[model samples]
Target: MKFMHISDLHLGKRVNEFSMLEDQKDILRKILKIADEEKPQALLIAGDVYDKSIPTVEAIQLFDDFLCELSKRKVQTFIISGNHDSAERMAFGGRLMKESGVYVAPVYAGKTQAVVLEDEWGSINIYLLPFVKPANVKRFFEDEQIENYTDAIRVAVEQMKLNTDERNVLVTHQFVTGAKRSESEDISVGGTDNVDASVFDEFDYVALGHIHGPQKIGRETVRYCGTPLKYSFSEIHHKKSVTIVEMKEKGNVEISTKELAPLRDWCEMKGTYMELTEKAYYENLDQDSYMHITLIDEEDIPEAVRKLQVIYPNLMKLDYDNQRTRGKAAFLEAAEVEEKTPFDIFEELYEKQNNQEMNEEQKKLIHDLVEKIWEGGH
Candidate 1:
């Protein structure tokens, strides 16, 4: 049996406040092209089918249209809910979609409820463990003590093993081993949100998500299918791809990855004002590509952005380099506001003001009044 696995689609996601729907659509079209060529038995979307809890009408239409095409081709699709997805919304009409070989696992109503798929080789049970909190699962199993995300996934995997045969795969939306998170990722409480790859030891293979980079965890059996399009400028170096797994009857699998080039590129540049405007720095500025610009100007250059925009009109940022500025000493000194308290500054200001405007008698009265207040603290 052969299949394609990918995750963190984050469809309908915006980049730099710009709609990335066209880029996402292009990538999905490429994925469909790959599917057409390979004709895989199954297509697994691990999680994050949408970018938000409530997706837009266009997002819904795009996903629906994609699924309808897959259904027409008799392709079996398995999807789960990610941290960004609303489970109830994703599961809407899930029962009816199952008839078309599209399965969406969102609710945790029971342990035995999993999507099972098959091919000429044998049956493959897929346990779709969506993003779930420990507290929510605790209500389902009152006697079970769950502590974190790791614990929650362990319980789900254990339940799946109880109901399925040996030839089983775990499709989950979670932070796991071998995943490299970008700066844009929201770090969870205490930074202990990720589950170890070893947690899925019982399953034949693990299709993971949440991280935007494709990687192999602990072993080749556990993998992450990165997002088709780059989510942030921090992900400029990432090579987005999908994992193709070929499974044999003996429970052995061969894996190969195919890269998915995005419709637009994300480019970043750092240079002084003159260098930035030079032909060497931005010779190939694609107006279509998203950009982040860091300016290394010694001083605030007038109309620096206007000048640069003439060359790279899509520039997203312009950062000043304080170190190179002539008045940096004053800038640094102005930033040391925490070293002294308000009372210290108030006393200094009183002396300065008295010296500038008050007579000796007035100064004496002010000193005496402040002295009495200071003595109260003693």
Candidate 2:
């Protein structure tokens, strides 16, 4: 069976306060076109269908149209709510929609049931597991020890009662440990919401969401299709695409990606104010495309944004990178921040503020407090 895997559409999203409605509309149209060419039997939208739990009216209509079009084409779409979505809202009308092959995961009330599809290989069980926290899962299993995200997921999977004889595909939304994150994704503070890849051992293919970069975790069958469009400057270099998955049998899964071409590409240009404004440098480029212009002039320009608007009207960001700006102390790199826990960062901040490392008593207090907070999350 062939399926198109995509996630984090983030419809109705705003990048640097600029609405992405038109871009989103256009991208969805393109995805529909791709679906036609690929002729996939199913489309897996892992999560984050909307940017907010309560989306704008226009955003809702946009998705409705997309779904209506998909239904018309007789393509099965499977969607799950992400952290940004309200589970109950996403679950609404799910039963009615299931009749049309639009399977929306219900607000996970304990166990996840499978939507079985048959092909030449026999049966493929598609399981929908929405974005779940430890706190959410612990309620259903009081006797189970679900203290962390890993524990929560393990317990949830345990309840699924997966059959080892058949092919299984799990569509879930969560931050699996070791996935590279882009600034666009936003994050869960304190590092308490990470699931281990080992918990998904039973499934033949795991279609994941949350992380903005398309990647395979541990094995190619376990993957994230990533966002269909770039949502932040940090994602400037991402070659966004739709992942196509082909499952042949119980033990065979193949993955490939088809790159998406957005309506307007993201661009970042850097040069001295005068050089950037030069006619020769600006004429050939697609000035209307969303862009970040970095002016390296030693002194700030008077009305630079206003002036640059004449050349690149869609300037999303403007800043300097001159001697004065470069003189400032550097902050921790994203890699460094990812390596340190929130508590570690907090302790470092305390020591820097007070000019001394935390004493043993303070350390113990902080440790206990962190532990309590982590438990409360579950």
Candidate 3:
């Protein structure tokens, strides 16, 4: 059985305040083109179908058209909601859509039934596990002690009663431990949200989402297809593509990717104002590609932004890297709260308030509290 795996569509997303509707529309078309050539029996959309829980009307319409096109091609499509999506919204009319070969995974409620797919090799089970928090699963299994994300997912998979004798494919949305992070993703404090790759040992192919980079974790069978387009300058180097998986048997699987080209590339450059503005620099290039330009001039360029827009209309960001800016002294030290865990920030506050560091016991108490809060204790 062959499958086309993709995720993190992030439809209706705005990067640097610029709407990606057109870019998204273009990419979807490119994916459809790939589908035509590959003719995969099934399509696995891991998650993050929408940029938000409530997507724009345009985004919804765009997806509807995409689904319609897939149905016309008679391809079986499986979709799940990611951390950014509202499961209730994604699962709406799921049963009805399945008649047209679209399987939308329902909201987590203790038990998740796998959709069995048939091939010449017999039946392969496709399980759908939407993005879940420990709190979401803890309530249903009061008897189980779900202390963290790994525990939560481990418990859920155990209940699936997987049969190791047959080939199984899991379509889930979660950040697996060891996957590289991207600037545009929303992750938990520290690495508390990671799900151990060992937890998915029972599956043959684990189709995953949430992280924006396309790569495998632990084993090649477990993979993230990544986004179809670059969502941030950090992902500018990413060769966005659709992952194609071919499974002949339980252990016999082949994986490859069909490259994608967005409407405009997300890229960056650094040079003096004069060099950047010269016609020789950008005249032969696609100036409309979204850009982050760093002006290395020693002095500020008057109305540099306005002048640059004439050549590169899609300038998403502008910055300066000069001696004056780099050599400037800090006005006040600011903590990188985004990079700190909840407990780490709390400890800093405790030390500043009492003019003393917390003891091991106090630290333990706060650490436990932080864990509890993430599990919905507060």
The C-alpha lDDT values of all candidates are 0.78, 0.91, 0.92
lDDT of 2 at 2: 97
Best by TM-score: 3
- Give the candidate number with the greatest lDDT: 3
Collision pairs in model 2: none
Put down candidate 1 lDDT per residue, 1-378, tens digits, no spaces.
888998887778776567889988888899998899888888999888998889889988899988988887788999888887899999999899888999898577636365666677667777787887777667777777678777777776776644335477888888874477885455554457777677788778889878887788888988888788888887889888889998887458899988888788888878777887778656756756777877776668898778877888766666775575536657666775757654455555655432245556866677777788878979
- Please give the lDDT score for candidate 2: 0.91
lDDT of 2 at 58: 93
lDDT by residue (tens digit), candidate 2, 1-378: 999999998888888889999999999999999999999999999999998888899999999999999999899999999987888998999999999989999998898999999999999999999999998999999999999999999999999999999999999999999899987765666667889999999999999999999999998889999999999888888999999998997788888889999999999999998888889988989988899999888889999999998889889999999767766524436457669976798798786444369999999999899999999999
Predict model 3's lDDT versus the native. Answer: 0.92
Summarize candidate 3's per-residue lDDT along 1-378 as a digit string, tens digits: 999999999999988789999999999999999999999999999999999899999999999999999999999999999987889999999999999999999999999899999888888999999999999999999999999999999999999999888899999999899999888888566788999999999999999999899999989999999999899899989989999999987788999999999899987989999998888988877899998999999989999988998999999999998877765523222336346788887888676444369999999999988888889954
By TM-score rank, best first, the candidates go 3, 2, 1
Give each model a TM-score: 0.82, 0.87, 0.88
* Total backbone collisions, model 2: 0
Decoy 1 TM-score against native: 0.82
Q: Per-candidate RMSD vs. true structure?
A: 11.7, 6.7, 6.7
Name the regions of candidate 1 deviating beyond 4 angstroms. 110-112, 162-165, 279-281, 285-287, 324-378
